[model samples]
Target: MRFTSGTSFDGVREQLFTLGEIPGVLWTPEGAVGTRPLIVMGHGGGRHKKDPDILSRAAHFVTGGGFAVVAVDVPGHGDRPKDVELDRIATENQARVAAGAELAPLIAGFQALVAGRTVPEWRAALDAVQRNGDVGAGPVGYWGVSLGCGLGVPFVAAEPRVRAAVLGLGGALASAADAARITVPVEFLVQWDDERVPREESLALYDAFGSAEKTLHANPGPHGELPAFERDSALRFFSRHLN
Candidate 1:
């Protein structure tokens, strides 16, 4: 792992050498380069913007399997120029409070970020990673938990380059039409006891999958946590399709 530069956050270092203009933490082994399969890790909703768990997970893929990993701060959360605080409140609170006006914009801002995924900035980031030669030549993969899962939906749908994805603790059946657009393999992990996100919603999404390779795994855990076995399953799923 290499330390590139500091980002908007105090201790968060930006790994721009590989991912170019994309704002994220890039991790790869020493003397690695090329258009490797990079795992784009997204964070869950909440105050875990600078969470060590998410960062450590990215490092594991980089060091354990030589996969390039980039974890970006989704709009409305983290160090991005959005309403980091308002996003933490409950949805009901957001609907009731005047301060929640910022929350809607933050959500819209996140959507905009995903919509622009194919634009120059994101492409430049991909180009930078390819230039570094750390990412091996393979189909790219994406992984996210909670809110990151929401973002990854459009990401994989619009970006055909993302051949595989793993989403945990965040999913909703927006509609059959939107779900039909996802053409890649996706492994969705959900806990039966999750209170934050209804299990029915995830089931609806699982039913809406158009990909022949999609899988749904249900385990036991809270909305904010995942069991050890689920984490292993997630990594294995990514490795299988990403490599």
Candidate 2:
């Protein structure tokens, strides 16, 4: 896999040392620009930044809406080269890995490890954005989905520069205390019948948010069925907070 940015956007560059030692795509709109809003986007479990489904919608956020977007490929997924895939660990007896039993700890560790890499990388990206001068110079925000949401929580929690966040189809951290640490306003977008992740977990997260400015949107549908709605809601929510 290779890290890539949209060639159509001007002032675009690829940052190699991003979260999880992955690559991030940075895109700035054409011609006139100065100190615009920045959004650090994250992909779902096994997708890349240029996922046809995601980038198609994301193009609106960058080119049409004029937001600088940086979407990173998570370690062991997307364009990042990986030695092993967790889901590939299947034996005769362990055909299906136990739900939370096998994945919870692994996901927790991945998020922690990824969070450790975010600050330095984000600072580097911020520095570059500032240097561009014509590009992003204002506050930053985050938008994430599925496993991305899991990582985004810790990312925003540690980096207060993120003014707001939009999380789609993902749960909060293991502890509400951890969730309470985030200071920015956040929007939790979830499907009521998400079978992959319990609906209760998302609510527990929404209920746990310590930020007084946060809100929760419970949309109708299942996990995969709601990505369109999630995208619209996230765009609107981020616009409200970022602007």
Candidate 3:
């Protein structure tokens, strides 16, 4: 990983970096002593690593929970070169959804294609960040919703370093079998009235997790309307596991 530039604010050190082709940001608490926990923050589909919500979550984890946070632009999103075929597929899927056509198949296909690229990119980011000795080696965790959850399931399952995870707001786009391999503590969130993900699929995804310590947090709201309190809850969850 290469550190390109950096700035600090509110006791948090924010740095822009590049891990090979993937561009990303790293956030660490300024006054944190010794080695601190690491949290990999994932953004929703169509969002970048520096998205406002993602940045806020990173800041919360670093400043509030004393963890180092990192986020990378998923393949074809953010600063990465856009894939023309994927863009066409996404547009087609949206049109199909508007016409009340079956969306699950299209969504799953898109996720599969993207996940193939993203899962490894996430690993690369983790490897690159860990190479920075200053970041320290501590318990690692993941925080992601929607597309983040879909890609993260496979990534976290394959990466044994991640001790806990917060994954949800996504459905059965990827293989539940992949989720079954994740045995770490997981806190899964679900939006009761999500317009995109079917409620049954969300619950089924949660049930498919192999983690013995998994908890489900469901609330009434649309896909993007997750309660802000859940952020605090995730922070607490990470604290309990990583600290």
Candidate 4:
């Protein structure tokens, strides 16, 4: 991993890094030293590691919880070279949207394909993060939703370092088996009126998890309208399990 730039603000330190072409951002309390609990954040579709929402949440984890946070751009999603196949899929999805066609099927297939590539990238990034003196090998947590959740389910299943996760806004399509492999404690969110993901699919995804300790918080909203309090709750959840 190579750190290309960094800044300090609001008692938090932020660094831009690259791990073999994967662009990423790391956040920690200013002047932090030694190993600290880590939070690996996954952003939604069309968003990068340094996306605004990711940054806001990272700040909370760093300044409020004193946890180190890392977020990496998924393959074809940020600074990485675009994938021809993903571009083709995106074109098709755009056409489908113009035709008022259902987007779930196309998104399910596309997310499944991308997951095969990103899970390995996340593993490699974590390896590098652990080697960093400040982040070190400590309790790790994951927070992802929508596209993030779709990809993260498989990653958390394949990588054992993540002890807790905040996952939701995703369905079971292309993810049930991977979700079944995840045994870490999870705080799952669901929007009752999510137009993108059918309610049954989201509930089924929650049911698919193999974790003995998992909680579901279903609220009334669209896919992107999770209540703000959920974010606060999620940070507290991470603090409980990771700190």
- TM, every model: 0.75, 0.79, 0.95, 0.96
The TM-score-based order of candidates, best leading, equals 4, 3, 2, 1
Which residue pairs collide in model 2, if any?
A: 35-137
TM-score of 3: 0.95
TM-score quality measure for candidate 1? 0.75
**Candidate 1's residue-wise lDDT over 132-184, tens digit each?**
55464567887776666666676667666778888766545433344578878
Model 1 misplacement above 4 A: 1-22, 47-50, 83-124
**Candidate 3: residue pairs that collide:** none
lDDT of 4 by residue, 96-179 (tens): 989998777778888999999999999899999889888999999999999999999999999999999999999998699999
Sorted on lDDT, best first, the list reads 4, 3, 2, 1
Query: What value does the lDDT take at residue 179 in candidate 4?
Result: 96
Which of 2 and 4 is ahead in TM-score?
Answer: 4
Per model, state how many residue pairs clash. 10, 1, 0, 0
- Candidate 4 worst ten-residue window by lDDT: 101-110
TM-score of 2: 0.79
Tens-digit per-residue lDDT, 1-243, candidate 2: 233333554434333334335566666665545788888777776688767655655666665556777766665667667635343442311443443254443455555556555546655655665555655468788877676677777777777778998865766544355678887898888888886667777888788777888888877788756656656667777788887
